[model samples]
Target: MIRQATPADLQTLAQLHSQCFAESWSAQEFARLLAIPGTFALLADTDAGFVLVRVAADEAEILSVGVRPERRQQGLGRALMAAAAERAFGHGAQTLFLEVSANNAPARTLYGALGFAEAGRRKAYYNEGGRKADALTLKARLPLGKSA
Candidate 1:
């Protein structure tokens, strides 16, 4: 189920980020975003796993989306992404963007399949434990009506 995330979901979301990303945000930070106005957080939950997105203004970014490592390649990520896109469009978004580590092939492939194209790159965008990692900025135009 994809729904607006609440403060109660922070711990689970934080744990997932720790498991999925080399560098994770602090619990306080996650909670802060949830408390901020104009910030939208969505979570998809089930026995399988969970996926999350943070949308601000007309741009939506995938804050954290993960399936237990054992459940990888089972389509949970795609489902979460579809929900994110739908929600973004519903909330007046015209475009969506995300940053992925340059070496993350699976993520790049998934975004490509979702109509996200490589729009640009940020040099040394991430600090991995210590070393620097470049980030690829991917973008996709959300379905918008003539009025948008």
Candidate 2:
């Protein structure tokens, strides 16, 4: 089931993130984000996936998203993205943005399928082991509606 996340879900979010990324964020970091005025998160419990987002004025930024490695390719990511976008729009966001490593084909594909388009790029944005990777900035226009 998908549900809005509270600060109490930080540890679980951190654990799930660790399984998906080489550099995982800590519970403390998650707490800090949660404390931010415009930030929110959504968790898919059974699917072991979560998405963090922050909305300010008419814009929303997706801070992070992850799914347990074993849980990927099962629509968990898509569900999380939909939830986050809906919530952000409800919070007054007209546009949603996110950054993905340029080399992350799967994630890029998913974002593309969700209607996110490339908006910009950041050079040497991710550090993988001793190597660096560029980041692609993507943005999508959110449907006009209240939060579901």
Among these predictions, the greatest TM-score belongs to 2
Provide TM-scores for the models.
Answer: 0.82, 0.92
Q: Model 2: what TM-score?
A: 0.92
Global local distance difference test of model 2: 0.88
Q: Would you list the C-alpha lDDT of every candidate in the order shown? A: 0.72, 0.88
Candidate 1 clashing pairs, residues 3+ apart or interchain: none
* Root-mean-square deviation per candidate: 3.3, 3.1
Model 2 lDDT per residue over 71-140, tens place: 8899999989998998898989999999999989999999988888899999998997878999999988
Residue-level lDDT of model 1, residues 10-74, one tens digit each, is 77777776777767766787888767655655655553445555667777776666666776797
Residues forming the 10-long window of minimal summed lDDT in candidate 1? 44-53
Worst-scoring 10-residue span by lDDT in model 2: 139-148
